[model samples]
Structures are given as C-alpha cells and as structure tokens.
Target: MQGQHIPTDAQKDEAALWHVKRAGGSMSVAQEGEFDAWINADPGNRLAYDQMRVLWAQVEEPARRMSTAMAGEKPRFDKVRQWFSPGRAFAGVAGAVAVGACVFFFNPDMVENIRADIVTENETVTDVTLTDGSIVHLAANSAIATDFADGRRDVELLRGQAFFEVTHRNGDRFRVHAGPAMIEVVGTRFNVDYLSRNTEIAVEEGAVRVSSNDNPQGVLLGAGDRVAVSTAASLGDVEKTDPTAIHGWMQGRLSVRNVTVGDLVARLDNFASGRLVALGDVSERTISGSFPTTDVVGSLETVAAAVGAKVIRTSPWLTVIY
Candidate 1:
C-alpha cells in the first residue's frame, strides 16, 4: 500500500497566506493567476488550503468563549476562578487587537487614493458635483474616481459607499461601477454601497439599470427597488425598500435587521476611529436595531446588550465585543 501524501510545512504556510490574501479581497489580476497556478501545482497544495479553511471555521465558537472570559465577564459556571481585573483583561485583549489591527487597519484607503478623484476620511461625508452637474454624496471612508468624457459620465467607487443624484443631459448615460456590478441611470437618485465584498444598489427616484459581470442583460430598478450583487457577480432578487431609509447613513444612522454581530461591527467600524471586533460566537449571533453611527461606543454597547454580550473598549482605536 502506498503511504498517504502529507503537505510540507512550507506548503501549509503558503496555503494559510493564500486564504488570508483571498479574504482580504484585494487580489490583483496577476496575483489571481499566480494563485490559480499554485492551486493547480499539486494536489497536496489543495489539501493544505482546505485544511486551513476548516481550521479557521472551527475556531469561532472557542474564540468567542475565550474572548468573553478574557474580558472579565462572568463565565457560565460560578466555579471558574476570575484571574484578572476588567481593565487588565481589556489590556490583554487590546494587545491581541493591536496585532490583528495591523492587518485589519492596513491603510487600504491610502492605496485607494492613488486613483481616487475624491476621498472622504472617517466620520466625514463630502458632496461633490461633477462637471456634468451630477451630485454625489460620498460617505465616510469612501473614495471615488469620476470620468466625464466621450459624451457620457462614469464613476467608479474605489472604496466605501455613495449616493448619486444624477443630472439629465440629452439622454447621456451616467454609470457607477462598484465591485462586480454596474449601475446606469439617465437622471435619478440612487445609493450604492460596496463596503462589504458585495455591492448593494437602491434607487430613490426615477429608474436605473443595474447589471453584474455575470448578468449582462441587467435588470431595471424603479424607485424603492433594492438589490445586491455578490462577489461572484451573481445578482440577488430585487426587494422593495423605503426610499427615505435608503440613505440613512447620510444622517449618521444605520438600520439593520437580523444582522450578525460581526457584520454590524464591520459597518460601525467605518464610522469611528480604530476598529470594533466581535470575538467568538457573539460575532455570529443576530440582532435587529437602529444604531447611531455617530455614537459608535454607545451603539456598540447597545448591540452587545441586545445580544447578551459584553463590550470592552481597550483604547480609542480598539473595541472588542464578546
């Protein structure tokens, strides 16, 4: 009988890097090709990557419990001895945040600004009127590059989200490119958010045509219509939305329904300095709430309370919820 092939330590490390790189969602064309080549290089390489993925998935629950205990929260059992004060506990967790923040806080915006025509910092929103008279309400931590040429208007969302009140001009088309999706309108008010790996589109007035890389035929969305396109370029079902609520972020508000703690943290992270990380199973729990984006610490506490979790603000730049 032949012995089973085992992936070498180098292969394991390379596989881990590949997983992180892909999760970062900033892979270049050349990097993607290199990734494909590496995956096809050997069967052992695939096995190692698969192992890494499984290991990552399995750690979530344990991470939650450990983080909760580390924050000086009351454990499930009274018998368990408490080892640290709340301040010291948060300091320990903050130390971990400091390490992870290096990756999470990696200045992607700096790179984004290289090609961005307009950029907004955290906690700030900007309004820009394009040469064609189209108005864009760019959200915080967002960047956009505009091109008004060839008798057409085009805007690419480099990062974050934006609301467009497009101006009509002799049937010339206005297009907004976000992730795998393209939104085209003649004259309309609409919102596009590409903060996550996916792109979400919502129309406020008039109509717009939305298409994705996979769905080139596209779909026409009227006012109050909302949809999302996944990272794989797959279109989601169109849903009805309230036009007034479509751009709530503009008012420093975020409305969520049955949203996971992890996802909520990610959105709130955009409005404040530093980062908010949900550790352990608490991150997976779901809750519904309307949070004030301007009051990130208060909002985090409210979210944690709703989910029966605890919030630990180790510093201005780091908050851990578990």
Candidate 2:
C-alpha cells in the first residue's frame, strides 16, 4: 500500500479562503468558479475547506472587529461584536488603552530603525544574513530583532533557538538577548537556545560574555563551553563539555545527554518528522543518546530498545511508547 501524502496545498488554500471570506468580501464569479474547481480537485481539499469554514465562522466577528480597529474606525456595538470586541471584554477603554501601552512598551527608535524578522507560529527555520555579513539561522517558532541602519549590529532573540556565525569586523560587536540573559561576542560561531524556562549557550569558537540583564554578575565562556540559565531561580550555571555534541542540531543531529524522557519527547515534537509520545512511567526516565533529526521514528525506536521500552508506531507521524 502507498503511504499518504500530506495535503499541504489543500490546507494552504483552505486557510487563504478562510481569510478572504472573513474579510467580508464577495468573490467574483470567475474567482468563485476557480475556487470551486480547486476545491473539487481533491477530496482532501473539500475536507480542509469544511474544517476551516467552521473555524472561520467561530472567529469571524472578532476578526472583523480587529480589522475595523486597525482601520481606525469607531467600532459599532453590535451584539456579536460586543462579545468579541476588546473594549467590552476588558473594561470600556481597555482595548484602546492597551494599544497605547503597546506603543509605549515597544521602543520607538528600535521599532522604526530595526529590521526585524517576524516568524509566525507555523513557520520553521527562518534564515537571514545581517548587514555586517553575519549569518543567523533562526529555528522554528523563533524571532530575531535587529537594526542594520546603525553603525553597530545588535540582535535580540525574542524566543527559541538560533545559530550565529558572525563575521569579523572592526568596532562591531554582535549581541543577542535571550530572556534576561545577554550574550555578547565578536567574530565568533555559537548557538543560543532559549526556551521559556531555560537559556542555553554553547560557544564553538572565539569567546562570549554571558550576563544577566538585570545585573553585572556573569561569566565569560570560551570555546567548547556551555552555560545554562534558569529563569525560575534567576541564576546561571556553566559547564565545560563537547560543544559539537550539544550544538549538533544546527547540523541535523539531535543529541541528548542524561535528558529526561519528557524533555526528549518535547524536543522531538519541535523538529522531528513524527509526533513522539511517552507512555507509562517514562516521564521520569532519562535518555542519553544521539540521533538524526531526520528519522525520528527510527531514533526513538533505537532509544526505546536500548532502554528496554516498547515502541508502538501509531501512525506515520505519531508514535506512542510503553
């Protein structure tokens, strides 16, 4: 039997149609005909359209209200709009006030001057070269804020992981801000993985200064060293290890050392080709192995066999363990 090919095109069309219909614009006869033809082209398209249509109906009012606000119009207090509008939901003036708050919170100079790469929820691995010839490899669910117009080059990693290969330049320092911890470097190659709870830094060459955003207490890390910062405790810890083993994900390898099963499953879900689930008492169990990010199922099976656990392939992209 042939394996199923995921309907990416159909899903994309469904999403596009949802946005079009939500904007409250009528499609031309030719356009509608073309849309119908496209939908009927495949059974999966119809199914995807149906699902998106349901979701469109649920958020139609809010979407319209947001559009109206963006257009700078006095929003109507229709019964449907009232339930979805930000004003009624959060006091009478909260919505407008929140917009002002956002403006104040975001630095005007930074917002206007900086050229930022904004990655949406679904986009994975956005790569960009900075003005100073530095290459930034942004991971999935990540964003980088930087300004190239200024004489100096600075980037703030809002969330997720990024690999930086900075070019050597005189009087230019490349800086990365991950949560409260800041990393400063010059002409270096390194990786920074900053999730919600943990901040990790591995230096491949040159050197980096890892410091807290709130204070001056930090440590300078050399090549082949790693540091982790815990946000919950606001403390930093350093360890000397093989940088390639920890930072191999940039090269398509998922390396883990004494990592818990729960953590492994979470990490695999981000970059793996399959959905990995841990069953039974595997949450507390630890795993120490290296695997390729391409073959998640094979890697999971190998790990499971090594640990004497059962590997159940629920589907092509879904796996359950026991």
Candidate 3:
C-alpha cells in the first residue's frame, strides 16, 4: 500500500456524481471502457457510487407514488421501498455490481419544471388525451410539452416526432411548434418529425399552415401533403404523399421507399432503446422496405443484409451498422 494513490472523500463524491451524469446519455465505445477503469481505481469510488444510487432512488420514490396515484392505480415501487428501508442500502457484492453498471440513470432525468405531461423512454410510446377530446400520439424516445389553457391548445415537440389529431374548439386553432415551423391545424391529423435541426410535416387530414424561421409567411398544406423544412437546408418540395406511407409507423410498421440508409437508420432510432450508428459509405445507399418497429434491430439486419453491409452489436445500448 506504500505506493497506492487514494482519492479524497471529495474526489469520491465528485466521481460518483460524474458517473451518474455520464450514464444519462449515450456513451461512446471509449467512454464505456473509461468509466469502468475509473470506478475500479479505488474502493471509495464504488462505495460513493452505491450511496449516490440509493439517494437517487429516494428522490424518484415520491414521483413514482404521485404518478401511481394520478393513474388511479396502486403503488408499484416494491424495489423503491426496499431502497428506503433502514440498513437496506444497495451494498456488498450486489453494491459493487450496481455501482459499476448503468442502472440508476439511463436517459437524462426529467428534473422539476419540465413542462411535459408525458415522456416516453427509449422504444416506448405514450398516448395522451387532452380535455378538448383531442389526442397526441408521442413516438418512442420523444418528449413533448403540452399547454392547454385559456382559449387555446398548444403542444411543443420538444424532441422527436408526434402525431396530432386535433378537434376544432370554439373556432380556436391547435398549433404545434417544431423547431422554426409553426403548424396550425384545423380539425385534422398530421405527423411532425423534429430531429436534429430538420423538421418534416406530413398532413393526413384537413389543412395546415406551415411557417418557419426562414419562411414565416407560411405555406398551406392539405391532406396527403408532405414537406421538409430545416434550418440547414431550403424547404423541401411540397408534394402529394401517401397517407399509409407517412402514418404507417403508428401501426408498428415503417414503410420507406427510395430513402437513403442514413435516413432509414435515423427513423429506426426513434423506436430503438439502443443507439444505432450507420457508418461511412453505406449511409448514402438507398433502402426500401416495410421495416417493423417491433423488431428494430432485426429490421436493421434485414436492411444490412441486402446491401452487403454488416451489423455490429457492441452492447445492448450500442449497435453499429456498416
């Protein structure tokens, strides 16, 4: 022990918090290995991380109870109650595994003050019904903030795609904010894809007014119309679209035609809990088929097989296709 370097108490606490935060988002291949080495460096690191896990669970217990109560269902936190039991801290051999593994924080925790009423985790979809008898279908890996007050209904696509079925209310309109686009709906259904910096709108029923930071004057879209407007590129050509092709994902099947593999992979990520990276030259290759959202990785493999590419699954949380 003469040459051993021990981390201070403060350093242990810092390392614990840092690991928790790093686990919040997708970790790269390098990050995963670095995380393992950092924790294994000192016994204090494992102890501090275990304590942080228990504390983090305690913070979430109340919210779980509240959500259960609001759903008119019984509490479903047996494991949470165990975490709170005196002398039942996540410890010992189990504690070491818990400290090293990513369990407590997967996606970023939705801190207090996030206005979203419903949030779907990776590969999960949440459907919300408003007081006005309208419905919003939130896709997987998506978050939306809803505001229905005064005389109007507004839903913001904070990230990912959402399908809105709006019902006209006392002559007031329903609006969706996707990046720079302001979509006003008049008793219609439509899908909005807001990922990265690009926004695409596909109208299925009625008409909508689409405006963006670049073209605020707005464009009118009727049923069966689709357009893509992004900050990085000029607005896409507004054209007639097939309703089935645009809205098929709602039924668990994604239909794509003449689309690049890059785009197909991006769409697949919406329903995949793990991260899928399409590398290099394969991105530009075209792909067409009806990919099932139920079997996300299988669909990727199916697509890869056709193009003489390969699917490399590094872990449950990371997959690479090339």
Q: Which candidate is the best by TM-score?
A: 1
Segments of candidate 3 deviating more than 4 angstroms: 1-115
TM-score (C-alpha) between model 3 and the true structure: 0.64
Candidate 2 regions with alpha-carbon error over 4 angstroms:
1-127, 195-197, 279-281, 311-318
**Local accuracy of candidate 1 as per-residue lDDT tens digits, 1-322:** 1126467655665665565456546478998999999988987788877766675455334444344223311112111112112332122222222323223223335566789998787787789999998899988888899887777699999878899999999998899999899999999999998876468899999999999879998999999999989999999889898787899999999876666887788788788665676655677789887899889999999998888987765433346776
TM-score per model over all chains: 0.68, 0.56, 0.64
- Per-prediction count of colliding residue pairs? 1, 0, 0
TM-score of 2: 0.56
Compare candidates 2 and 3 on TM-score and give the better one. 3
Q: Which ten residues in a row have the lowest lDDT in candidate 1?
A: 72-81
Cα deviation of 286 in candidate 1 (Å)?
2.5
Whole-model Cα lDDT of every candidate shown, in order: 0.73, 0.59, 0.66
Candidate 3 global Cα RMSD: 11.2
After aligning candidate 3 to the native by TM-score, how far in Å is the CA of 107 from where it should be?
A: 5.0
**Model 3: per-residue lDDT, tens digit, 111-151?**
31166666675555668898788988877767787777887
User: Which lDDT tens digits does candidate 2 get at residues 19-126?
Assistant: 333233445678677777877887666665664455445544443334333321112223322322332212221121122222223322243224446542322566
